[model samples]
Target: MPQHHTLYAAFADRIDAVLTALEHEGVLPPGTPRGNVSVEPPRDPAHGDLATNAAMVLAKPAATNPRALAGKIVGHLEKDPLIAGAEIAGPGFINLRLAPGNWTNELHAIAEMGADYGKSGMGEGRRVNIEYVSANPTGPMHMGHCRGAVVGDALASLLEYAGHEVVREYYVNDAGGQVDTLARSAHLRYREALGEDVGAIPEGYYPGDYLVPVGKAAAEEFGDRFQAAPEAEWLPIFRAFAVERMMDMIRADLKLLGIEHDVFSSEAALQAAGKPEAAEAWLRAHDLVYDGVLEAPKGKEPPEDWEPTQLPLFRSTRFGDDQDRPIRKSDGKWTYFGADLAYHMQKAEGADELIDIWGADHAGTVKRIKAAVAALSEGEGKAIPFDVKLVQMVQLLRDGEPAKMSKRSGNFVTIADMVEEVGKDVVRFSMLTRKPEAQMDFDFAKVVEESKDNPVFYVQYAHARISSILRKGAEEGFAPSADNLGLLGEDDMALVKRAAQFPREVEMAARTREPHRIAFYLADLAGDLHAFWNLGNADTQKRFIVAQDAALTGARLFLAARIGQVIRNGLALLGVEAVEEL
Candidate 1:
């Protein structure tokens, strides 16, 4: 027997004890490795409640037959008070069925914990920095940036539920050439704002009408003083003004999706502080960077004017990268990778773990960044883990046709327009329906439809249905109370078993850094609740409300309440609301 607060943890601990007992009995060698042991729910419910592959995994190491080892393990598991039966099935697997009362106890735990039921301490309060949706400070955020925003926010929430101190960060690309173009574009608009016939926007400048207002704002604030000024004088002023205004637009767009980063690190600020140069100097002293003549990139033709020039490069290949990455371009200017390396070096100083969520187009860049972090750790003699999660594109559809593109952001659809069309909740939920790295389609018609195929609607309706039942039961003078919980039968216990998996699912999602798993789990749990509710329509005896039997009605209603409680908790992790009614 093992003492753990959660059901799965208890079983896992007990399985470990069985292995240790086998070691003590001389059935296996002392100090045998048990990393491969896994206790999980069987795929087929008919197999048993819980299944362990301890024997199958450890048999070869113990110099024994798997079936024989399974028989020995089952004997020890059968003696546990909570286990009703233990049997060996399917090639050296031990399946154990818990007593029905154990599920009732688990339900009681849910009732006591309420919204906090699924939260776990698996992360152990480790500091984790999650950087996402780092759209450039050029214009408003478009639909292309929506998936990473939702995925990152939900992941932060999920990690918090699993006990990690998560820092939501956004890196602002304010120092790049994009912002320079924005400045020149705004300067053109600024000339027009002063009633000048600036003619058409120049070929290289941004053409979006959104910047017209930014120029107008600058004119109203600073007057015509900047119009007659030289390019050198006005360029910095316009760049600063345009970037601040664009960042404001980005913040407002993110607000519509309920996302606000804890820290907005600026690349310009990093460069201004000489961090990149300092990092380069540190790397050079450590022999991590060297002057090198690069070979032409394979699989792609080199530029016609390409020459074998000596430039600074990081030894990324030593850390598993495909090739040595250049830290400085041939022009002797620090490249974007150099700035990012310093940014991550700063991040590693504060956090134990770093996660950067990027759009799928940046997939080719993952290895070099990982190598940089690995080199940083090796140089500092302190290990820091880094991961990059790439979110794929989302194709928006309406009535099976591509969505109308937004003129506000030029060719791309703006986040504001999407939110205005289908509401923020639908947009957030739909973006998360598929894995972050897997491309998906968001159909406006399907997302708002009342059908069960719409995951958001399906999961929300389940919670709404439960609330309606609780209200109906209340009006009929039947209320749920803990004292009458034992009246729930085996069928109700089955639902509790499903609800009990929430904690495990939360841990798994957090461990994998995939919040979509929570959405999927909630969808399945919602399906189970819907199926359980329909059982009442076919048989009056299965109804949750029994007018003449308050005790039985109370027990069933308590189970329903637990189901609703779990639905709320799971939805909260995804930042979706659990509605009281459809």
Candidate 2:
């Protein structure tokens, strides 16, 4: 699109010229620094169509009053023929109007580019790895993980569309106390499969029937081998089988929600790959390892040997961490951060950039993770941009009431439950409809409803409505034509102009790692399209399929037809469907 700059580009160029002249004429200092300048439609269109803050930002920096600088910038901009007028307004802002033909040409760009109208190459084909939904393999995913899954997948798609080499990954928690607990639960279920009475589950043990199959499979494979062994003897065998089966079920559950990862990095594999011990060796080599212990957790006293025990530690505080982190526990086993450090160390091998999608509960852990990455990279933090997206909690609703999680299970709604009810599209779209930082309401009744309030329905319906119009137009021997798209009038042009925003917004969302922006942009475009479609009812001549004038109607139909393509293209990026009807 940069090769083919539209009227929008020319307007920006005119502003650039105004800035350049201001600097040259000494109205502003000769070498004053400036941030990237942006020109877009003003919030209140009555002031002018487009506005920029070039004057406001540079005013004090150039040692001049902001309003005075805005006046000077406006004076230089008013000379451009494409700019109908330029005004200095509120807080030294410069507002400019186009010559009425600029927006018309944006419509032509949409018709010409079709589905590719808004694509960008801003990424320059850099490699980016987005690791999300690393939900523990202990059970099925729930509503809380959906946000990360959708956001991660959408970000990967958006990055690819913006010309980046993207990889979506999931980190499996196959090694840990949780997996050991899973093994014991499976062993209990094994007893159940043998027709033995396995009484109530003990505390800290998995009590769900979901583990029964895992236990039965273990018994079939190992037989009475573990029946006579100690806890250590059965723990390994049980954990191996449990993690594998748990991962399989987790994958199936994720598939049901329409998500798949390109990579599945396992914590256990790090140990198998000789990386956990290698991390200990690494900290030792860098002088980052030290032996020290003093205080226990707040409000708790340590054991008898708690006095200054020399254990290995990673000097993470040197890289801006609040405090140095321990790598080896008092028992010499690697701490969780030790394995995570090695995991991220392994991640640094193939992935140029890493993004972790963590839930709100682990919000405090982000600082240490980033500090660890920086320490491991030896202070080159920008190359390995370890971004941690904190997904807020989900409060499920049912029958217009606050839905409570199963107290017996000790958690909120499961992903399987949400998928079974709202389906993949609604679940995915609803997860992305709001800012990740803000609270979102997921209404069961409204998600399934066929109303404009439902974003997924509204966007899909816009595409379907366009399909109907094109089908009707095809019956009248009309099809889209890039040659005569100028025949599309003001209302139709509005739809195209909005469609043209997708490519850039898609790139922006990816660059910023906020997939919610794409979801919102699609809805904005869909709203414009729906408004334009409804306009046909009020203005008969503006109807897409006009039987009387084939050429004029063909131009309008062609313009509107591509709007559906844009919507579908945008929806596809978010992993949301673009239905042709209904």
Model 1: colliding residue pairs: none
**Candidate 1 whole-model C-alpha lDDT, 0 to 1:** 0.89
Report the lDDT of model 2 for residue 159: 82
lDDT of 2 by residue, 1-582 (tens): 443353445567777777878888988777676666677667775676678988888878778888988888877777877778888887888888666567656766666676566667767657888888999888767777888788878888888877788888899988788888888888888877777787888988987768878878877998777765788888888888888898898889889877888899888888788897876776677777777663465576767766766677777777776667788777877788888888987887776788888788887667777877766776334457689888887667765787776542456677787888778888988898888877777878888889998888888888888888888777768886656665767666566556656665775687788888888988888888788767779878878877787788867776776777778778888888887788
Q: TM-score of each candidate?
A: 0.97, 0.88
Q: Per-residue lDDT for 1-582 in model 1, tens only?
A: 112267888889988988899899998899999998888899998887999889999899889899999988988888989899999897898888998878888888888888789888888759999999999989889988999999999999999988899999999998988888999999988889999999887788898888989989999988999898998999998999999999999999999998989999999999999999988999899888999988798898999998898989998888777889898888777788998999999889889899999999988878988888888877888889898999999988889999888888777789999889888888888888899888799888889999889999999999999999999998988888767777777667778888989889998999999999989988998998888878889977778887778888888888899999999999888888889998
lDDT to native, each model: 0.89, 0.77
Task: Rate residue 465 of model 1 by lDDT.
Answer: 92
RMSD of each: 2.1, 3.4
